[model samples]
Each structure stands twice: as structure tokens, then as C-alpha cells.
Target chain A: MSEVPNLDIIIKGCSKNDRESQKQLYKLYYSYAMSICLRYSRNYDDAVEVLNDAFMKVFSNIDKYDTARPFKAWLRVILINASIDHYKKNLKHNKNQELSETQGMTSDFRPDNEIRYEDLMRLVQKLSPVYRAVFNLYVIDGYKHKEIAEMLNINVSTSKANLTKAKANLRKMLKVYEDAAI
Target chain B: MQPYKDDIDQLFQEGLSSGNIPFDESAWIKMEKRLDAADTIAFAYWKLIYPLAVILVIVLAIWLWPGTSDNAESAPPVVTENIETHNNTDANPSSANNESSTTPEIGAKEKESYKQAPEEEDNAETDTTTLTESLGPSKISAENTDEPDVVRATVSENEATENSPSFTGGGEEYQSRFGGDLKILEGLDWMALDGYRGGEVEMTEVPMDTTREEVIKKSKLLFGLTVSNDWSAVGVSEFTNSGPSIGAIVEYLVLKRISVLAGASIGSRKYSAVGEEYWRPRWMDRSPGNEINTIAANCRVVDIPVNIYYHFAPKGLNQFSIGSGISSYLMLREDYAYTYNFADPNLPDTWVWENRNKHYFGVYNLSVVYRRQLSDKLYLGVEPYFKIPLTEIGIGEVDLYSFGTTVSLKFKK
Candidate 1:
């Protein structure tokens, strides 16, 4: 892991377009940005792309950054927007439809059982782009369905439906993992 | 399902959030390359825009300076006293005839004094009077019968002389037989007239009646077409979304100096963004490297503006005006497309997103307009305008403010 520098100095350097400060800033936030991007993206490669793009934006608009705000939060917002932009660009080919009827899942699963992080990531990646985006935005990011609807340019009901379907798909994937572990 | 669903969600959320994913070292190299490329393109765009803006400013300054001079030359002085007298005489012709018959005797006395003056010996005034008297009683009767023409001609002739004193004393002259005032004496120094003509001096009559009627008749409606470059005022240097705007408008002159304008315009705004999309090939067990896409969001807007203008000189050929209005924007189409690097070589890459249900926004504008009359019915105008958003354009919190210069061609009816 790269040692994080003082944010104020890094921001100032980035604002001046200094490559070393930008590289340092990118390294410090790399893991956090990757984690968020991965949840919103289809695969590890897509997550890396989102991370790079987000970092570029951070470096480019560093002058607008306020020192009072958390840099991580600001970086996360850019990543989310980048992810959505990616989705929008590829929306024409996206064949995933909103499942109208909610699917019921088995209730016998244990919550305390440990699951590998890689396994969880795989399950999350299996969900459709719309479902994954809605799921991550609502469940992990704590955004309301209305806010998600506005951000993604979709109806609130569609946002709710996608979240429900994402959870259902995850439950089924988790069942297989649980069975294999046993 | 509900009881276990919460636990499953918590497990996934905690698991995903806790992981310390390693950054790919190779991705930074690609990202740095893209950042460098973007910087070059941005610099090139600025290099083009800066000179264009400076040239436009200089051109506008040159055009506006001469416009004031043209307007000053076109606005004729208003003949207030003559217009009132003419209207009264037209209403009562019998009274006009009585005044005309008696005024000529006084005019004859004035003519004698005018001729006796040593300076008046070489004057053209004596010849004009001789020509009128030799035309006989028929012409005299005709002049007495129609008084307005005689008065108008006398006024026009007096106005032609630059150095002549006001018609208070030496200025009065009898109506010539030619139905016009006598010409000035020849010995008068023409140099005095030329010297006093400099600056904003009133040189001609306004012809109030004709001007009022012409303004009421010809200036009721106007149509115009405009083209401009628009950019955000608040982060002006940082904003790269400045775009071109085109519009057509119709104005109704509610009063001579004030008009109400309504028009529709189509314009676009663009911004650069970076994005990534995932692709997995059937041959590979793991996902391939993320494909970097440089995207530009192009937003097309349809705007309708309603404004009221106050003209500095509505009757003049060249006029300066200030106006304030409200413009409503309806988002017609918005698309995010990859501007660089097509991923698929074989399949025709149609990568774009069309957004719907876009909310309408409003902007308030203040503008200064300079119009130069090209002909009796056509005018060319340059308006520099400032616009402020009354409402947010989209979900974004940034308030969009813009300053632009518009060049227009207007037709008045």
C-alpha cells in the first residue's frame, strides 16, 4: 500500500498538474476507488477503468475541490458518475429487462457463516448492469430510490424493482456457495 | 424470505466493503497516457477559442463606434411650431387666407429693409423675389390660396443656411412666387457655416407629423434571425461546454420605444467525461483489461425567450437598445457517445444513450442591442447578452450562467 500524503499539499500539486503528486494521490485512493468501482462494474478490468477515469477527473478538477469536504467521498461520487456514464454508453446493447414479479428465496440460510470476499464479488458481478448499479447505490451507498431514479434517468419503481431482483439473484448464488461449503 | 434477505444483504455489503482490492499497476500507465492526450486536445481548443474571442471583441468595438455617428445624422429635428400652425390652418382655410393677404404687405416692408442692407446687394434673395413678382397675379393668387407649401418651402430654405441667424428678426422672409423662400445672399462667408457644423449640433427639422405617422405605420412588427456562441460565466475558464446557438424571433412594437419580443432557438452544450465498460471474451476465463472510453455528453436544448426592449432612438436608422427577458429551455435530446477509440473493429459500434423525461429549465437574460438600418425595411444588429439560470437544468447542482454575443438580421414592417 502507498503511504498517503497530506491531502492539502496533494490537492495543490494536482491543481498545478504535477505528475508526481497526481501519481501519489492516485496510489493512496486506488484501493478505495477500485472497491467502489468493482461493485458498480461488471468485472475487475471495468473497475480498474473506472478507477483510472475517476482519478483523472479528480486530478483535472482538483482546483474546484474544497478542503473542508472528505476527499474520499468526492472521489466516490466521480466514480459513481463514471460508472453510470459507462452504463449509458452501453445501454443500447444491454438486454436486461426489469423482472416485474419478485422472486421468493429460501429462508434457511445462516447469516453468520463466513463467505470469501472473492465469492461475494463473483455473485455481485453475475447480476445485470442495471441491477448491480441499483443494488450498490441503494444498499451500499444508502441512496434513496428516488435519488437513484433521478441519477440513472429511470422511474423510482424501476429502481426498486431492480434492487429487489439483485437481492434475489444474490440469494440464489449464495445458496450454491453455502451448499458447497457444507 | 424477508427475514433471511436482510442477513444476506448485510453479508454481501460487509464482505464487499471490507475487501482491500489491489490496484493494477499497469492501469496507471494507460490512464496517464489518456490524461496527457486529453490535456493536449483541451489546450488546442483553448488556442482556437482565445483568438476568436479577441477578434470578435475588437470587431464589435469598431462596429459600435461608427453606429453612434450614423444615428446622430439620421434623426431629423422636430419642426414643432410649423407642424402646429400647419394643422390649425388646414382646419380653418378662410382664416388662413385672411392672414396670408395681410402678411405679404408686412413681408414687402421686410423685403425693402432686406434689400437696403449693404451686405444684401449681391444676395440671391433679390433675384428670387423678382422672379416671383414677374410670374404675375396668377402665381400670387395661387400662393395665397395654398399657405402650407409656402411656409414649408420658406422653412426648408432658411434651414439650408448654416450661419444664418434665427428667423426672430433678420430671418423673416416673404414667400417667393416659386412657392419657396429666397436663396441666401452670395457674399456671406461659407467658411463660418463649415466651422460651426462640427459635433452634435441640430442641423435639420424633425418633421414631427411625418415622423410620428411613419413610425406608427412602419414599426409595428419586426422579425429577426440570430447566431451566437454561448459559454458559462461562473467557471468560464474551466467550462469547456460552450456551444453555438441559433434562433429566430418576432417583435411587436407596443410603443415606439418599447417592444415585446418572442422567439425560439435551438442550441447545444457539450462536456467531456471519462468512462469504462467491462467485456469478457469466451476464450478467456477471466475478464480482459478495462477499455477506456473518452465520452462527450452533448445536450440539445430548445429555448423560447420573451423580452421587452427600450430603444434609445426608435425613429433613427441606427439605434441602441437595452432589454431584459425570460427564456425557457426544453431539453430536446441528450446523448453520451464515445468520442475516441472504437472498441470493436468488426461490429459497427453504435455506442450511445438517449435520455428521456428531462425537466424544463428557465434562464433570465439581459442584453444590449445595436441595430444599423440596412434599408427602409431591413436592419443588421449585434446584441451582447448575459443569461442566468432561474432553475437547475438537470439533477446537477451547478448553476449554469452564460455570456454570448449574437449577430442578427432583422426585417421591420
Candidate 2:
């Protein structure tokens, strides 16, 4: 971390519209941003698109960034907004589908379960767009039900209902994974 | 229905937050291209707007300025025309009447005496001499006794009025008829007026050489002291301050109606940064738990300005001048300090000062000066000026626009 260049100096350079500084900043946050984008996007290509859009916005509005606040938190907000914008643009075809309620076996998996991060990401991506957005906004981003509703442009009950359905679907997938492991 | 909600949420939060998922390096290249495109668009808009804004300001300043060609041509012509008309109607008629009455008396008496007896005309000449002496000194000679009566009378009438001490009312008429010729009269000594019924005063011919000399003599050097309050704001920053400035200027006439002025001033302004404060790691300072909070700066500047002023009514007591100039500001001192809090109670309240660069900046100024002459050599004036900086003042941080009203006292020599 000490060997890495100072973020404030890099941000100042980016504020001056320096292309190299922008690239440096993008490379620094690329992996962290990609993880968030992947959860919101349908595929790797869509995630790349979201990442590009969010980074462009960050570079453009670099002047507004206050050095005192955590830079990553500000960047996270921009990426989330980019994701929401991407969702809204493709909303006509990417509408959430109706899912029937499923009853599944409750398995007590220890903390040392063998689920890789890649498997978790795959399962999260398998969820419908609306459920995935709500789940990401509420669960991963720590937004309240009301905030998630506002962000997704849905009511609180719909957000709560979507979170429940998302959790049930994940449980059904986990049950399948557990059965396979046994 | 969803007892495993907490588990699913924890599972995904931990999994996603911790994931260092690899992304294609080509995305940065694409993003850089997009950023470049956006920057180009922004630069294009700025390139268009900047020149347009400058043109608009210059056009507006020229249009609104008082001494512009339109106002100069329109105002002075109307005023001069009225003065000319008044002088022509009032002074010309009265002077003509005075000449008509007095000239006939002197001419008829000489004519009658000459016709009665050529020898006796000498006695009549003595009488005429006495009459002329009573009236004033006459330029008419005895040889003019043979000339035409009207011509002789007109000559005597003009001479009488020119020397008459009582003819103060004809001053403006004399001035109008013989432009700058009265400058000669200003050098002469004359006696007080006694009532003398005489002919109307005639206009005199003025020498062109003396007129130029008098105009040159009237062009005086002016020195002025000004005090003003400038309301200034940093470029695109939500911080502004009103500061006092004091200056002295010297003006010299470069043309008949244009003068060049140069001056120096000193002023100070305070600025504060706008935003929320958060603690970030400080690598430079070894002090424990140092957290940056508020940032503020006070800038002291010295300025030198060169301006060209156009006086609308140079001879009038109420003078309106419009000028434009450039000023160079030397940043004498910039105290840029930021407050930082320490998590340790043992560390007292602390502030760190940052070194500011760029000691000089330039600004363009447009001003309107309205002056009322308090005396022949003293004038009191109010100048409202607008200033736009050519470069940012504080490092790369801010540009400033200043509007000020300066009250000045000027002395002319």
C-alpha cells in the first residue's frame, strides 16, 4: 500500500483531466468495481459496460470529489447509480419474471462450506434482474428496504417481497448444492 | 417463510465484498476512450462559450459606455448647437444694434462738419476726439473721415466696443465670433465701465497660432487617490468576500479627448473551502491521529493597472469617462491554512499551513468614471469597475471576478 501512489495526488491529476491519471485510478479500483458491476449485470460484457460507464462518470466529475471523504464510498455510489441506469435502459426486456414459491430442505452448513466466490457470483447472477438489483441494493450495499424501494422505483412491500423471494431461490439452489456434495 | 434470509444476505455480502474478481484490462482502454470523448465534448463547449462570453462582455461594455462614438456624436452636437443658436440669436442682435446706433452718430457728425466747411472740420475732429475719449480708446484714424460713412461707422463701432469697459454682456458674443481670440483679451488690463451710448460691438478675428497654444496650456496633468471596496468571488467556488483597496493614479493627456492612466493598489480577501470534512491518512506528518478538517486562506495582493480613459465632456464641470485596462496582481502573501483534529487528547488544537505558488496574475478591467469638478483644479469622482481575471489566482484552485466602486479625489496641475 505504501509503494502504491497516493490517491489524493492521483485524484488531483485526474481532476486536471490527465488521461494517465484516469487510467491509473481505473486500474486501482477495477477489480473492486467489477465485482459490484457483475452482481448487477447479466453477463461479463454487461458488467464491462457498467464498469466503463461508471468510470467515465467518476473521471468526468472528479472535481466534485472531496478529499476528506472515503473515495471508495463515493465511487461505490456512482457504480450503483450506473447499474440502476443500465437496468432502466434495458427494462422493457429485462423485467422481473413471476416465480412460484418453493419449499426446500434447510441445511445447516458450517462457515467452512466449500462454496467458492465464483459459485456464489454464478448463483447471484442466476436470479432475475429485479430480484438481483433489490438483493444487491439491500443485502450487499446495506440499503434499507425503503432505500432499496426508492432506488429500484418500487414500493417497500414489493422490495420486502422481492428480498424474500430472492432468499428462497438462493436456499433452493443451496439445497441442490448440498445434496450434490453429500 | 424466509428464515434463511439473514444467512443468504450474510453469505452474499461477505462473498461479494471480499471478491477480487479479475476484469479484462481492455475495459480501461475503452473507458479511457470514453473519458477522452467526454473531455473533448466539454472542451468544445468551453472553447465556444469562453470566446462568446468575452465577446459579449466587451460588446456590452462598449455599448453601455458613455464616451462611445454614438453618445459622443449625439450629445455634444446637440449641446453645441443650442449654445451656438443662443449666442447667434441674443448676442449677435444686441451687438449689431449697439453698433448701428453709435456708428451713425459718429459718422453723421463728421459728415455734416466736412460738408459745412473743410477748415472747420478740424474743430469738429477735436469734438469727435473728446467723444471718442469719453466712450473709450478708438482705433479709427482721421484718414477714415474720407471713407464711406457706413464703413467708417462700423469700424469705429467695433473699436469702441472692443475697448469699452461696460461691454461685459458681449463677452460670449466676442468669444463665439472670434474663437480663442479672447485669450488675448485675458492678458490685457482694462478700466471699469462707465455708461456710454455707443454702437454695437463688432466681432474680432482671432489668430490660429494662439488658439493651438491655449489648447495645449489647458491640457493639465491629473493626480488622483482612490478608495474602494471590492466584492470578489473565487472561480466556480461558493466563497466570496468584500475587501478594501486603496490606490493612487496619474493621468496624462495622450490625445485631445483621451488620457492614459496608470495606478497601483493593495487589497486582501479571505476564502474558505466548502464541503464536509472527513479523516484521511496523513503520510507526511508523523503526528499521531492527525485528521484534516476545515481549510481557509487569506490572500494579500498588490496590483498595477494601465488604463486608457476617454473624457466625454472635458471642459464641462460634470465629466463622464469610460476606460478599459489590464491589471497585474502580485500575490504578496497567501496564508493557506487547514485545521486538523487529533484523536489523542494530549495533542493541542493544530493547524497546518500549505505553501501557495504562482505569485502573479492578470485581470481585465472595464470602468465608468463620473466626476464633478469641485474647483478649477479639484474633482471628486465615483468609478464603478468590473474585473475579470485572465488566470487563476490561488494555484490551480480558483478564478476570481471582482466588482468595485472607487471614490476618488483628483487634483489637476
Candidate 3:
């Protein structure tokens, strides 16, 4: 990881169209952007794709950047657009149906032990792209359901429904582990 | 009880830290390589093509168009006003009789002042007393049609010379013929001049001038009407996704090329989905009977945009403009968001509302506009501008930006 500069310095460098500056900027915000991507993505791959696209736009338009703003805030907007673009392109082909059915879903549980973070992550990864995205955005990334709905072109109700469902599913997964321990 | 929800957050945070995220090494490498090998040469080459072609075409056409400087110097101007009047009166035999028999006699001074054009001289002495009586009402228009290009009517005591009655003014014969105004009409050159001083100046009927420039300018103003279109992206700050937009414009000119623009494009910032699919409950499947459960309740204004703009453009055809100005915007809908939860699939699909702490503020814009001048006072223009936020429109550290195009019309002052 590179040492991140103050937002002023990054914006000044971006205005100069400096490549290293752009790369540095990307590194600083890549995690946040990627987190957002994962939420909207079907898998890690799709999230990464959205992240890359968002970075590309940031680079091309860096000269148009203003220095008075927080860098992460600006980066978030780009990531969101890129994610929306990615979603629009890949939405039809997504196999969301498989992840929608809650019936007969099996959960892995740890007996007589505290649950591992890694194991939780594995379960998150196992979630359908749509569910994972909503869960991450609402719970982890702190995005509002309305925003998610607009970005995803769905109704506000859908976003709310998904958040509730995502949380419930996660709770269920965690319940299995508790039951196993018992 | 297992602390499922509490542990899940930590688990996800851990997952985020690990090397779980995928990277496209080759794609990034190729993209970087392409960026490194910039195509400056291709761009440079294309730049020269337009100017050269324009210069060549202009030069060749000027060479072929007939030069008329010498002929213009010697050619007699076609008489306009005075000649037209003389010809009108001469063509009517009834007018000739009226001139001879009018009851009202001309004043001696007036009779001596009127002079007939050379063409009308034969009937000059035919008791012009009657013509003098008819002069008051017809004089206003008569100046436009009178025949003689220039007639010097000097009242001379030369007796009613051809044995015909002549209106005498102060013991002199009066002549009534004169031609066009040389000095006034001389300035009506090939350029776009102001309204009529010599001929008709009515807006309802523009005079017939068939030159290319005149036709183009007139048509531009005649069809002049304004039109404007703009769109704004919501929930985006540094990088905004322009959302659905609304705007209004008006075009008013002879050529219909000039326009006045006032519109607001919703440009908060751009955004992306976490992926092709956002998060959702595993139980809500939207098939035959489960349709209600498939309903999606959206999040709140985590990021929303409100944009306002005012633009001006001159003349141009499609995708072109000839003038430039500013595109001002005000960002209203910040990144605040609300959420709605849905009922379980086993139950019916119902919505539950929730709100989040999202905020937005600040303003940003692009000032470049593409202007095309289609006429003297008309234009069509487009601005494919981008807005980069100076600060987060919201309280978060998320960056915001947006890209979009706007069309405008410019009018002559």
C-alpha cells in the first residue's frame, strides 16, 4: 500500500493527469469502492469489474476534479455509477432465482465454539449476488434503501424487502452455528 | 443464544480485509499499456483535415464565381420609385382624362414646380389642373412609382407650349415626374442591412431579395423557436449517475436557429450497484403465486441530486453551436436515504419503512459548450460537460462526479 496524500495534493496531481497520482488515489479508495461493488455484484468477480470501471472513469475525469471535497466521497459516486452500469449490463443473465428460495437451505454450524469471522465471510460469499449486494450496502456500506433502489432501478419496497430478507437469512445461518454449539 | 447478528458484522469486515476480492491483472495491464501509449499522432492528424478542406473549397469557389466589379461600375441602376409612378399613370387612359379635366386648378407656384419625366412630356400640357387636384391622396405612393429617374422641374414662362392646358404655378409651367432616390438606395448592398428606408418595411411581407445570405438570414429568424433538454443524476457526488431529467426551452427567430435555455438536469453524482444483484431475502421468489413476495422495497436518498442550469447559444445545425456561456447548477438532494423492508414470502409481500442518515450538498459544473452559428442571430449548441464536486454533498467520505450533455440556443442582442 502506498502512503496516501491529503485530498488537496491528490486533486492537484489528478488535475495534472499524473498516472502515479491516479494509481495512488485508486489504492486509497479501492477498498471502499470494492466493498460497494461486492454488494451489487453477483460474485467477487463482478464486484471487481465494477471497481475497475469506476476507477477508469475517475482517471479520465481527474482533470475535472475539484480540490475542496473529500476524496472518498467523490470516489464513492463514481463507484456507484460504475456499479449501476455493471448491473444494467449483467442483470438479465444473473441467476438470482437460485438464491431466492429459502426452503431446504442448509447451513454450516460450529459446535462448542465461537463462530469464526472467516466462516461468516464464507457464508456471505455464498449469498446470491442480489442478496449479498443489498446486505452489504445496507448493513456494511451504510447505503439507504432508496439509493439502492434508484441505483438498481428497483422499487423502494424491493430494497426494503431485500434488506429484511438478507438479515433474516444471515440470522438463520448464524442460528445453525448456535444450535450446533448447543 | 448465539450472537449471530453481532458476529456477522465482524465476519464480513474480516472477509473484506482478506484476499477475497478478485483483480483483473491482465485487463489492468492492457489498459495501462494503452494509456501509456497515447494516440496523440492520430488525433494530431485528424485536426488538420477540417481546416484544410474548408480553405480549399472556399478558394476554388471564389476563383470560379464571376467577378462583377467592372460591370457594376457602368451598369445603370434600374429606376425604382419615380419611374414606377410615371409608368402607372401613363398606362391608364382614364388617368390621362382626369388630369385634363380636374375641376381644381393648381396653385401658380405648384404648377411651376412640377416636371414631367421625358417619357411623359408629351402629355405634360394636357390641362394638368385635374392631375393637381388628384395629387394629395396619391402623392405618398406616387413617389414610389414616378417615372423619371431625375427630373429638374424649373418653372419657366414658356407659354403652355404645345397648345395644351398646363397647370401654371406663379406664372410657370409645373412638371410632376421624377425617378428613384439615388443617394438613399445606394447603401442597400449585398450584406444583411437593417429594415427598409426606401421600400416597404412591413414584417408581414418581407421584400423580395433572392441572394443566398438574405434567404438564409430571413429563414433563420422566421423559424426561430427555442428548445432545451437536460438531465440530472441523483445519489451521486464526486461520481454521480445522472438520473432521469426534465427541462424546457424556446426558439424564436426568423431562421429558427437562435434559442434561449433554462433547465435543470438532476446531477447529484453517479453511482453503481454492488453488483448485478443487490442484497435481498432468500425467501422472496417471484414466480406464479409468489409474485407479491418478489416486490422490492427501495432504500432512501443515500445519494440524490438536484441540478439547475441556464444556458445561451447562437446559431448552428445538428450537434453544433457558435457561442458559449456558463452552466450553473445547484445540488439539492444530498445522499440521505430511506429503506423499506418487505414481508416474508410465506406471508404476503408488504412494505416496512426505515430511514438512514444520508446527506448531500455543494455545487459543481462543466463550462464548455459546442456552439454552431446557423445565422446572424441564431445558433444551436451542445455541451458535453462533466461536473466534479468541490466537496462531498453529503457527510460521508464518498466522492462525487457526473458527466452529461446539454443543448442551448443563443440570440442576438
Which candidate tops DockQ?
Answer: 2
Q: After superposition on all CA atoms, what RMSD does each candidate show versus the true structure?
A: 15.8, 18.5, 17.1
Which stretches in model 1 have alpha-carbon errors above 4 Å?
A1-5, A96-113, B1-6, B44-54, B57-304, B308-326, B330-413
**How does the DockQ of candidate 3 come out?**
0.15
Better of 1 and 3 by DockQ: 1
lDDT of 1 by residue, B1-413 (tens): 21223476688768787888776678788888887888787564634544564465455444333224443233222111111111211332222222211122222333344344434433322221221110110111121224453322222222345554333111123332213334322100111111111111222332235544554345467777777777653333435667887778898867646888899877776554443321211211111443435444556767788989987643234567899999887766654433223333221111222344243437898999988655434567899988887875532323556777888766653
Chain B vs. true chain B: TM-score for each candidate? 0.44, 0.44, 0.26
User: How many clashing pairs does model 2 include?
Assistant: 6
Error of 3 at B121 (Å): 16
Model 1 chain B worst lDDT run, 10 consecutive residues:
B131-140
What is the C-alpha lDDT profile of model 1 across A84-149, one tens digit per residue?
877776677665544322122123223344665765676677688889889887887666787678
lDDT of 2 by residue, B138-193 (tens): 21211122223311222223335455543322334434544513211110000111
The candidate 3 chain B region of ten consecutive residues with least summed lDDT is B136-145
TM-score of each: 0.53, 0.41, 0.43
| Chain B TM for prediction 3 | 0.26
* Candidate 1 local Cα displacement, residue A133, angstroms: 0.5
- Model 1 chain A — which ten-residue stretch has the worst lDDT? A100-109
TM-score-based ranking:
1, 3, 2
Candidate 2 per-residue lDDT, tens place, A57-83, comes to: 788777766566567766776788799
lDDT at A27, model 2: 85
What is candidate 1's TM-score for chain B alone?
0.44
lDDT of each: 0.56, 0.57, 0.42
